[model samples]
Target: MSDRIDKSLTRKKLDKTLKPHWVWAIALGSSIGWASFVMPATWMGEAGPLGVILGLTLGALLMIVISISYGVLIRNYPVSGGEFAYAFLGLSRLHAYISGWFLTLGYICIVALNATAFSLMLKFIFPNFIEQVKVYEIAGWEVYLTEILLATILIGIFTVLNIRGTTISGRMQFIFVAILIVGVLTITIGMTSSAETSFSNLTPLFTPEISALAAILTIVAIAPFAYVGFDNVPQAAEEFKFSSKKALTLIVLAILFAAAIYSLMILATGVAAPWQEISQANHAWGTGFVVQEVLGTGGLIVLATALTMGIFTGLNGFLISSSRVLFAMSRGKVLPKAFSNLHSRYNTPYFALIFAAVIAIIAPWFGREVLGWVVDMSSVGVSIAFFYTTYTAYKLLKWSEQDEGYNPELHIVSPGKKVVTLLGMIASVSFLVLLLYPESPAALGMESIVALLVWIAIGAIFYMIRRKELAKYTREELAYLILGKDQFKLKKEEE
Candidate 1:
């Protein structure tokens, strides 16, 4: 083979430093951030305790099915940018750009959400220590200069850590996640063992105002945000030291584990006191207040510790994922080429990391309440990416069977596999409708809708600005840049 052919086959850029456990930690950490800690009461308020369990379980099952499509694509392509690379190869460059843009929005929003959540956690623990120096107010929530500074400092620390390399960040993720799990388990045990707790406290299981089905769908609608981290597995496929076949198992496990943690937190919150009372209380952090109410100072301390770890893991994991997506898009010429450049010693996407961090740092200035609006909007973005990925897998499988010249090494050749991807597509679409449809229980408010529209408009304008430059590259050249010339050649050989 010529040197050109040799260069095409190898992925010598990003270091393969992620172990199986680190990947799992990243997925679980990303999925179980501030929402799991602070929003249990909100979920209880929306659907009641039983509704929270039902919705999260159903949502997780749906995600597991969707992950099957991700598994298929990762095994076949195993590139960074996850769905971005899949859509580019199985669909078109336009589809790829759409997927990358929305997914990037979702990941970056989560990163900012976690950073802002850090201040909220501190407020609950110290009660105005970090809430000093009020800067402004938006949407009934005050934006404190101290909070912004604290959040910015956290974002800056993670940015430098991530720019150094993945191995360091990955190891830290594993440790933080382990401590977080212990903290959650401690809370669960304490709540269950307490004399003040009772299963009867979970009465009026579903909210009377909404139908039970609607209540369940409410949680299911935001499942994309709740279970966002598992897809990070695909985003880091290029950095996997293990077999791509393992990606599916890791993704599924992460989703299931995250679901359990969410359920436990809700359960602990419910049994600690009359969940209805807690739901109705004027507490800023309902779960925190309830835990502290029943278990006192000891309980509050444990819960605070867990919340801190959850925020850290979220920041670390999402930074890694968001940067990788940008890097992959840049390498494929979907974005500016500077983002594709890796650090000399770290072998990491330095420019992309810095860019994501800057966006996250700016988010706190908008006030913590406004970040929630962006997060709700970002759920729609993630759903769009999920649809594209599942649809691409379905399309690839159909082509393989119908075209005499096409055959890739699919692990499971069962006729039923296509049905899974089809179901995934349907599920993905349902989540989107539940979020975007006004009649749906989980529909976004006007503010969130405006945010989503603004993001879409910005993405469209940015793509048009880069379209002419991207148009200059042939499909083959783009494929070589994204999939590695060797991998692209191998794909051609299979076809």
Candidate 2:
């Protein structure tokens, strides 16, 4: 039911109205940004430096591989489907629906988690002022004058920028990205300057202890959450001056930048604090404590501020992407039509955005762990989606229709694509196992399994509800929907 949104709201193409940087801003924001502050802080506090490193490594590899596979997909059909397009073009409609649900749910959780984190951090940084002005509960348990006011103000800021238009939001992200780079560089160099970091720490060893292995895998499970921003490339496709090859360039560049940056920060975090403190991060936060310890109150302040900015941008990025998914789906007639309405003045997926925003923010309350956990579980969903897609790509390459974009000979002999696709497949499947392992130090464990089951069940129900309408649409419709109709029409030559 991916592209098969309700008939009245059938899948349609996006308006070509954005700059290329907007694409990079949102995609890169989701892909890496400043999420580093959240993880190793918790991990460093609870597990150890090794656990934090392992968690980051796992997430990065998973995201890179999965995103690379998606990169190949979007290169062929650059548009806003995200997983919706991936499933619609490569796999079953049911699978596409599942992908949509996973990404949607994952990002919704991100928004709420970020908002909550933002509120808490603001209170932490400026306790007295936030206190006197409070109007809501602390972590949903106790009321406070300051926290409420802070949450209200921040949300309002984000909402206004979002509602005003994409241009304003894009500019905001551009500014944040500058700040993000400074914070990331500062943290990385600060940690690097300290004596503990060594090439020795990153040396590979396969001998895995039961405890170490489980902890490593668990942390790794959540690791993919770190690299999820690749999907945003497709979300920004409508804005690109060129459509074809847009997806390929965007994904590759985004991944390389993110990987290098993350690798640097991870090494820095390790060097700044001992393995013992970084691992113990599971209790209060994660490795953030060590950063505070080493960087002094000033460093901590910068990181916390960076986290706040990163989380907000990440939240906004997802809200933007998820709405497009729904909008495309609604146009396809797989779901209700009301989801596709755009605000004439805002030129945004106004209703879809607002609806998703409200739901995304409040939904995290039900979950055991809000932000990272939600993002991790979403990775689980995408893992399933990627497996389906890689298999689909293999199958499509083997026997796809001639007129469509299938390349049978390339699958076997295109060594580079073959290797990357295989890597993508392995990385995805590995993350799935990591998420399920009970003893993982990253803490996903069996609960992740339950989360996956619940999300799948929900997705299944949604698919079944829309099956009848979707059945009428043939592969031809699916193809057009995947490759935006506007994309096929080349611009008339300006004489």
Candidate 3:
């Protein structure tokens, strides 16, 4: 394997987004598993305050393992494709197909959920405009026209930002995430005095019921989503100068910052309203829920405005991350070359991004709790990706070149790394096993294999038969493929 070379112009411009420290900070912070706040965390905590706490603790523990191991992989085998890129290096083309398919589907689900949230916010800010959907209902249509319109607009914005390239997209992420953290803190602190929190509720004592474990696993499992957005951060690696080191640091810091922020918000919100009441009264959170809960009318307006912008930013995150995954797949010839194309001017993958937006625009009409369903599948994608990477890591440790070739800066063989990666894989596989059970699958396996398979098939057919026409995006992805090329070989280099 070759060292990562600065052979591409597109990558160089992307480096301008953030230098080393900013790269690590932005990437790490950007991936903060945010949907946990938007979806299950609030409801779970509300439904069973103790239950959610236990679950969050358990899930966070597992995620810590998963995340650290993921970081190791990123540090060792940095690349533009998130999980898919890693898999392609270690696993067979078949597993590569599997990983990319799941990630693309997972990202689509992310976009769908983000777009859905954006549309819902639009309805809140302009109820009359959304109320126009009633007119569509009268026409015997099952879909909500206004919701679709609003969603399309959000998707359009994401596609446009993504077309502008990684630097712009990543900075956009930093801006939104920054505001989102501040807004959440302001609301949580202003509303719930930290001293008011009941210490007993802070640590729930669960009975001997399995519900405790399952529920906790579900909650903790979600923290991975908070970190999942980092998947896109690496997609822009080609744009970084010292991507291997800088990108890894950025991804890790982002996770830590986000985790801290979430803990504070949960603490504040938990104090403001009892878990059960918040769960029962306000299952869905947005501008209305946050404001009404925190500051009444004033809070409502403030939260509404912040939420509107935050969710729109989330949509942008989805657009850039998901499309990048597809773009990476396209470059590998697993997908159509069109997906790999760069806008000669903006230096973004225009067609793949537009493709992502179109699907995101259409997802809301499914009216099926877009986030709820997507979260389950996204969990699957996360786990599957983790599983492959960890297994590859195990292989890396056992078989990488040894006999004096070593990376003292890297720590793949340390007991801590080993234990965590193993446990992370266990946690991921456990969630997957739980999904096989019909009763719990919906809660943890919302990602659609059918959907994934269809997308992969489409991508493959286009690549094999239709790739000749689309211009290819180029430049060497050396370090990009090295980390996952089998751990044993890395050991050999260590020698």
Candidate 4:
């Protein structure tokens, strides 16, 4: 083995202040957003309570397997950019850019997705106030000036809070997550304790029209989108005060906790009233409708409060995550270096935060359905990142085993880790198949497919433009910037 020094490049680092609990809060909070509260109708309609619960449980298991791959990568290379950095180290620069591009799509679009949900929640609580001043319509969904203003204001607030610093944002995330948990428990307990509820209301475990496997697969296919937050941990790895090994436990715990909350919300919906009726009733907010039925207007107020917090947490978490991804990519010279600029006093990625917020603020103008198409497309991007990380782990493990000169001191690969990485890759491919396969129940709509194509085209154009700028640097110089000075010494032969 040979090691060489690359002295020309200097790495920029984020502030390290995230505690273990705060990291957990970030992952859990980001995963459980307005979708849990506002949109159970589609899943509940396709799969009854039992099917949904089973599906989510299985999904969590798959995520845990994938988490093992993430943990292995983090243990070996604890850096910012998560999958982007991993792909570059274990795969190639081209793979890294692809991973970063898709990961950016997933993280940044979610910021807009959550912000748009805020306007929808306002419309639910104060229809007269929020629905006024109709601006325009896209795909039959009305765009209101009030809604746009509300979303923009939210995006702006979170952008400023994140730019202030991660310490401030992490603490705020912890508190908001606590409130969210309390509110969720309150709603679930109230709905379950109501005299009108009967567990039998969840009967016919699967939707009669669909096969049981399909019912469960429908939810399983969206697991990448649903369980995205845990990966955010890797994005902030450079700033982790604690050891990266500890993050694996936090990730698994967060995934389990999120899964429990999701199942409880679905259970609350089913038991409060006949799930079939709630599904068929087709209320804009099915969960909200049931809450009002069980606990009256007071319950609606509590649920709305919880949902608002969810939206807030989602906005804050994704802003932190997306900005960090941008900063990492910029540091690697894959994106414009301007994105890596930091705030003078606070030391946050101000340019990236502002850029992410600006993109999100513009989303509400196009209306909710248009945003939905983007989100649907973004899920594919999320799954792509997952696959890249898992595949990277698989490559590293196999390389370690096959290389006669492999250094055990460098990385100790436990006997069964190779198997786990293989399983993780299989699970990731399954998620992709479910989303992209036309015959699959969870396949993307035509609009979402078009959105996916557009995003890929945009990435291709940007990559071509960036490659010319990057031609000035040798491969070693590029590795020093992306993997840092210490890691660049350990770089493998270029593929």
Question: Which candidate tops TM-score?
Answer: 4
User: Model 1 over residues 1-495: C-alpha lDDT tens digits?
Assistant: 233332443333688889999999998998888789999988999998999899999999999999999988888788889889887876678888999998888888888889888888888778659878888888888988988888889999999999998889999999999999999999999998999889999988998889899889898888998999889999999999899999998888889889999999999999977788888886889989888988999989999989999999998999999999999999888988789889998889999999999998888888777888988888888898899889878866652355554555433354566799999999999999998889888889999999988988998999899899888765666777777643343243121
Weakest ten-residue segment in model 3 by summed lDDT? 486-495
Best by lDDT: 1
Q: Provide the global lDDT of candidate 4 against the true structure.
A: 0.85
Residue-by-residue lDDT tens digits, candidate 4, 85-112: 8878767788889999988877888898
For candidate 3, give the lDDT of residue 353.
86
Per-residue alpha-carbon lDDT of model 3 for 1-495, expressed as tens digits?
334433442321122343454354444443543353454335344334455555545555565566665666666665557677666545554465577777776777767776666656556556677756443332233447777777777678767866876666656666666666677777766666544445344344332234665555545545556556655565555556565655545655565665565555555555554455554565446325644655677666655555655565556666666776777776665676688787888767788888888877666676645345555555666668778776665444422336244454443456556676677678778766655455651244324544434555665775456334322311234223222231223321110
Give the whole-model CA lDDT for all candidates, comma-separated.
0.86, 0.61, 0.57, 0.85
TM-score of each: 0.94, 0.80, 0.77, 0.96
Q: What C-alpha lDDT does candidate 3 achieve relative to the native structure?
A: 0.57
After best superposition, candidate 3 residue 326: deviation in angstroms? 1.6
lDDT of 1: 0.86
Residue pairs of candidate 1 with colliding backbone atoms: 8-486, 9-486
- Please write out the lDDT profile of model 2 over residues 433-490, one tens digit for every residue: 6666554344464555666678778778878888888777655454456555422222
Error of 4 at 262 (Å): 0.2
After best superposition, candidate 4 residue 55: deviation in angstroms?
1.0
Better of 1 and 4 by TM-score: 4
Residue 249 displacement in candidate 3 (angstroms) = 3.3
Q: Please identify which of the two predictions, 1 or 2, would achieve the higher TM-score against the true structure.
A: 1
